[model samples]
Target: MTNFTLSDLESIVATRAAASRDESYTARLKEKGVAHVAKKLGEESVETIIALVSEDEERVISESADMLYHLLVALHLKNIPVASVLTELARRTSMTGLAEKASRTPQASGGRQED
Candidate 1:
């Protein structure tokens, strides 16, 4: 038996994502399907941003944790790994922020304004 590690939260997220519905919140989120998971992520992100704008470090940290947790759940729902996101981030790390912003078109996913 290879006893490596669930040392990383990504591993934890993966396991939780794959487990039976009763076994974990992340798993439950997966069972509920993509739209539900996406809604939860959106809610958490909004909470985190609200905390940030209020300049409350404690709430910011707390909500940010919730945000990341739900994001992992969303990723699991979509079969996308955290590393994929991190890799894209790594690829963009050297690019000028303004240039990156300009490089993105308004029609990209998540860029549409609410009705």
Candidate 2:
């Protein structure tokens, strides 16, 4: 089986984003701007949460894929590389979760940590 990775998806998104909007959904989404792509990412996050709570494995997998795709698109819109995210994840792994949480400054909303 082919091992498809996030790097592969990132490359695909980059390529598709260059296409004419009429020919590619990724291109069209990029045209709509970052806020719109952020909205789509939020929608996918909700769907993923619902699927997770429902205990539907297939649905969870599907929604998670959508969420990741939307997330990558949103990152691309802002010129953030997936490698940068992965690097943060790697850095977080060097510490205990609680320690990592403690290291972060508390935001007004109590700082959401996705690590």
Candidate 3:
């Protein structure tokens, strides 16, 4: 069995983003801009949620894969490296969830208000 990591998937998606649009769905999505890519990610998220609600483990796995792919595409569109996300996750791991949430300085735009 081969081990597949998010880094591996990110690299593959990056290559696809560079491929001819006619030859790569990833490239086509990138050409459509961030709004389109975000919409695709949202759709995949709904599908994954539906699959989970229906208790279909296989479908959940499939939709989760689609969601992750769309997420990676969105990240690439914004030039945000996967390592940055991982670093944030690692940092969060150092604190309890509630403590982490409490520590965050909410943005003025629809973010949590100061206590």
Candidate 4:
């Protein structure tokens, strides 16, 4: 039970996303479907990048939170449970990073990485 696993974040986001239209911003965004959620994620990601490059620690933390929240929203709209994703991650953990990289055959990890 890690305090801040990605699964925990997913649960929080999914719960908030299910709220009524006026209940929470997450709910409102969820109501707009995956496209809107993805748009928000993109915006937050840019904010995080800015924070990483030129902002203070607090700003980086804040923007990272925002990015994570929007990402969860997107994932929720797609009906993907955190547990399902974690299962995949757990599987990946069994392999070495380099081995995992090489194991993802040509067509899988983005078309062979252009040699």
Candidate 5:
């Protein structure tokens, strides 16, 4: 089996984003703006949930790939590197899930949340 990392996928997505929109779906999605990318991500999320609820492992895997791709596209559109997300995940892993959840301070207005 090939070893594929998220960084590898991110690189591919970045390349596609720079490609001609007519030739690249990723480029087209990027041209459509973040709202479009976010809508695709939401659609993929629902499809993935449906696959999981139906107990279809293969479908779940397929839909998950779609979901992750859309998520990566969304991140790209916002100029957010996947490493930042991985760092957050890594940070959360240091604590129990409940503890992590409790640690998050809700956002006030449009400002950043305080821990």
Candidate 6:
């Protein structure tokens, strides 16, 4: 099996995002900006959830790939590196799930939750 990783995907995303929009779907999608990328991400997320609920392993895998690709695109648009996300995940792993959840400060409004 190939030892591909998120880091590898991130590299690919970076490259494709820089290509001419006429030649690359990633560039085309990125040209549409954050709101559109986010919408695509949401759609992929729903599809992934549906695949998971139906218990079709192949569909779940495929949809998950789609979801993650969209997520990377969104992150790229925001100038956030995948390593930052990996670092946050690693930090969360140091604490129990309950502890991590409890440690988060509740937002005052409908603000984004802190990671």
Alpha-carbon TM-score of each model against the true structure:
0.77, 0.90, 0.91, 0.81, 0.90, 0.91
Candidate 5 lDDT tens digits, 2-114: 79988999999999999999999999999999999999999999999999998578999999999999999999999999999999899999999878877776652235644
Q: Record all residue pairs in model 5 with backbone atoms less than 3 Å apart, i.e. clashing.
A: none
Output the better candidate (3/5) by TM-score. 3
Q: Model 6 Cα displacement at 6 (Å)?
A: 0.7
How much lDDT does candidate 3 score? 0.92
> Candidate 4 versus the native: TM-score?
0.81
lDDT of 6: 0.92
In model 6, the runs with Cα more than 4 Å from the true position are 108-115
lDDT of each: 0.78, 0.92, 0.92, 0.83, 0.92, 0.92
Lowest lDDT block of 10, candidate 6: 106-115
Q: Which portions of model 4 show Cα errors greater than 4 Å? A: 1-5, 112-115
lDDT of 2 by residue, 19-73 (tens): 9998999999999999999999999999999999986899999999999999999
Please identify model 1 stretches exceeding 4 Å from their true place: 1-7, 105-115
- Model 5 RMSD in angstroms: 3.5
**4 or 6: which has the higher TM-score?**
6
TM-score of 3: 0.91
Worst 10 residues of 5 by lDDT: 106-115
Per-residue lDDT of candidate 4, residues 63-97 (tens digit) = 99989878777878888776777787887789987
For model 5, the superposed segments whose C-alpha errors exceed 4 Å read 108-115
Error of 4 at 108 (Å): 2.9
